[model samples]
Target chain A: MSTPRTPTIGLFGLGAFGRLILRHLGPHFPLTVHDPVHHDSAPPERAAACDIVILAVPVAAMAETCAAIAPHLRPGTLVVDVGSVKIEPARVMQQTLPAHVQIVGTHPLFGPQSARDGITGRNIAVCPVRGRAHLRIAAFLRRVLGLRVILTTPDAHDREAAVVQGLTHLIARVLVEMEPLPGRMTTASYARLMEAIDMVRGDPPGVLAAIETANPHARPVRDRFFATAAAVARRFESGDAGGEDQRRRSRRALIG
Target chain B: MSTPRTPTIGLFGLGAFGRLILRHLGPHFPLTVHDPVHHDSAPPERAAACDIVILAVPVAAMAETCAAIAPHLRPGTLVVDVGSVKIEPARVMQQTLPAHVQIVGTHPLFGPQSARDGITGRNIAVCPVRGRAHLRIAAFLRRVLGLRVILTTPDAHDREAAVVQGLTHLIARVLVEMEPLPGRMTTASYARLMEAIDMVRGDPPGVLAAIETANPHARPVRDRFFATAAAVARRFESGDAGGEDQRRRSRRALIG
Candidate 1:
């Protein structure tokens, strides 16, 4: 049993983002970790029975992990997920976890690479699922962890994250695949784009999959992006960009 | 002639970039400026006959600008261009201008927007065409202008820049057209991408046109990018990304 001051936090999964959470949360809470490999520091039931359960596993493994721990969750305990998407994970947790356990869905905006220095000031979207316990979670994330907490619903979080995370990861995936890019002779925008790519290229593959596939809103955003990008490509390729004089005039007007 | 110590510099096309040049070079040299509009302070012939001539015109107007100034250029005078691409401008200058004048092709890697603060550490590509005078220009750019001058041939500059400027502008173009991108709940990478887009979104349309079409090497890079990006979109849309366990293993491998 945890002391009243320090709650027990059961963290499932030890991936890159999981370790980041561990690094921060370990100082404040008593931790019981479970991983598919040999990193299980406690029994699955013991971890699930803690005061707070944190599922850091991929969306693919959420169902299995939730099922394995479902029977052991104590009444009045809090269950949280740090998935990239909100709606899918929120559904899986709400459906699988016991109705007595409180659920909060959070999407941490910074990746392991981006948060290498620290998680301070980084944004986290907190979606309240089954209970008002999200207020407590959001407060802890805000005051104790030095994070920027955005309280939102599952659908609302997914809609914005569809374009935010979806397009970013998609761009990062393609840019990283196009490696050996020019390191010199780069413009400021190119440098910024490359920096953006660097921040997400090292993200786990599951993160990309979850961002692109798990979120329902990602498809329409992707459709719009590809459609718009293809049109731009065709215009440039066909050399049918708007009239040179008008563009020059507009540029001059802005400059003057 | 003002004095032997201060040579007159003829600046043509007083657009945004031309104004940037005037701001920097005006303090150092005796300036004679000309523009297509009412900003022409000197006769076109007088501007062309200055000791050194700088062309800050668009690629579309390069031929006409060069033809207008060709007959007035003095022997042993130096002519330089600050175009986005090198090969086309270099060809225009070499073919149109008299062989008696020295020519240097330079692409100031930073635009007026990027150089808003200053150009102290920015990059400038110098391609020597018909003269040994590029040596002096490179020295002045390195020493006086505080620019990192990359000396290369027209072909080499275009080849490398095709990827550097080509893809950056292309991506910026598409992303900008996808306006009202989510500002809140943005990841670090998304923020970086937005910064990149902001830096180039205001670019004159001619700059984008020159980067995409005027540079011969841009087409192949664009084709490759579009092809790879399409494949990525297809894979994600079809949900045919690699095996989930494989990705998890790789992510765990990286994290652990």
Candidate 2:
């Protein structure tokens, strides 16, 4: 049992983002970390006994991890999963956890790379699954961590993320594959684009896959994005020699 | 005739980019400004009388503008066209200007928006088309303007730009249309990408059209880009329920 002075936090999955969360949250709360591959990590039962249990695994492992920890959690344990897409994790937590346990679905928009300077002022979206604990957690995230809290539903977060993250990863993957030499010759915009690509350059293949597949809305947005690109490319290729002018006019009409 | 201490310079376009050049070069040289629509601007013949002539028109107007001013230029006058793509403009300058008039093809990689703060350490690609004027111009651009100069052939510039500018504008156009609300929720990369798009958002339709069409190398690169995107999207759409695993494996093979 945690006293009012120091509530124990069990941080599951000590990956890059998970470690980041630990760095910020560990200083304020008594923390116990558990990673499957880490020899130093505590056992699942130890984490389940903590006041707050944060599941920081990849979206693919969310369901399995939640199922593994559900039976060990106490009646009032607060279970949180920080997945990029909220809908799946929200559903999984609601279904797997006991009625007495609380669930909060969170997506920290910035990761280790982005939060290197600091996590202050970064945005975090929270979707409360089955708890009033979210109100207290949101306050803690804002007041202690200095993060901007966006309280939204799981569906709303997924719908917006479908365009935000889906298109970002899609374009970045293609641009990186092209191996563009946007060196010193880069225009201001090109330099910004390259900077964006470099940020996600180190992300794992699994993370990229989950961003594309785990969110149901992401597929439809990806389809529309590629189709729009293909349609524009086709117009450029099939046009007459003098078709450049017509194409310009049409583009203005379409985009403007 | 002008003294070595102060060369009379004529700027023949006062558009956004041209004004940026003016803000930098105007104070150094005895300047004459000309724009066809501006009532207070000097006529073409007046610009022709200057010791150095700079045409900062869009790529589409390069040939016609060069032709209009060709007859008025003195035998020893240096005529330079600051165009984005080099091969076409280089050819236009070489064919239009008289043998006695020197021509230098200059593409200032940074523009009004890019150099808004200042152009110190920015890059400028100079392709020598005719005579030794390029040597002097290059030195002036490097020493006085504090620009990093890349001396390359017109073909090389066009070839590299095909990938750099082509892919940038292509990706930006689609993402901008999606109206991504990348404000506070932006990851590090998405923020950079948005910054890049913002830089080019105000560019005229003509500039976008020229970037796609004027550089012949851009077409093939654009084709490969769209084809690659289509292939990836198709794989995602056609794969079974467990497609994410297969897709990630294939993307690893393809990109890695």
User: TM-scores of the models, in the given order?
Assistant: 0.94, 0.91
Clashing pairs in 1: none
Q: Per-residue lDDT of A103-183 in model 2, one digit per residue for the tens?
A: 899999887777889989888999888979999999999999999999999988988887777778777777777774657
Q: Quote the lDDT for B83 in model 2.
A: 81
List the candidate 1 regions with Cα displacement exceeding 4 Å.
A1-4, A246-256, B1-4, B244-256
For candidate 1, give the lDDT of residue B205.
72
Of the candidates shown, which would achieve the greatest TM-score relative to the real structure?
1
Worst 10 residues of 1 chain A by lDDT: A247-256
Compose the digit string of candidate 2's lDDT tens values, residues B142-185. Answer: 99999999998899988878877878877776666666454655
Model 1 residue-pair collision total: 0
lDDT of 1 by residue, B1-256 (tens): 5655677899887878999999999889999888757553677888899999999887767877888899999999999999999999999999999989999999999888899999998999999999799998999999999999999988898888888899888888888888888888988889998888888887777788888888999999888887888899888877754446545564453212
DockQ leader: 1
Pick the lDDT winner.
1
Global CA lDDT computed for model 1: 0.84
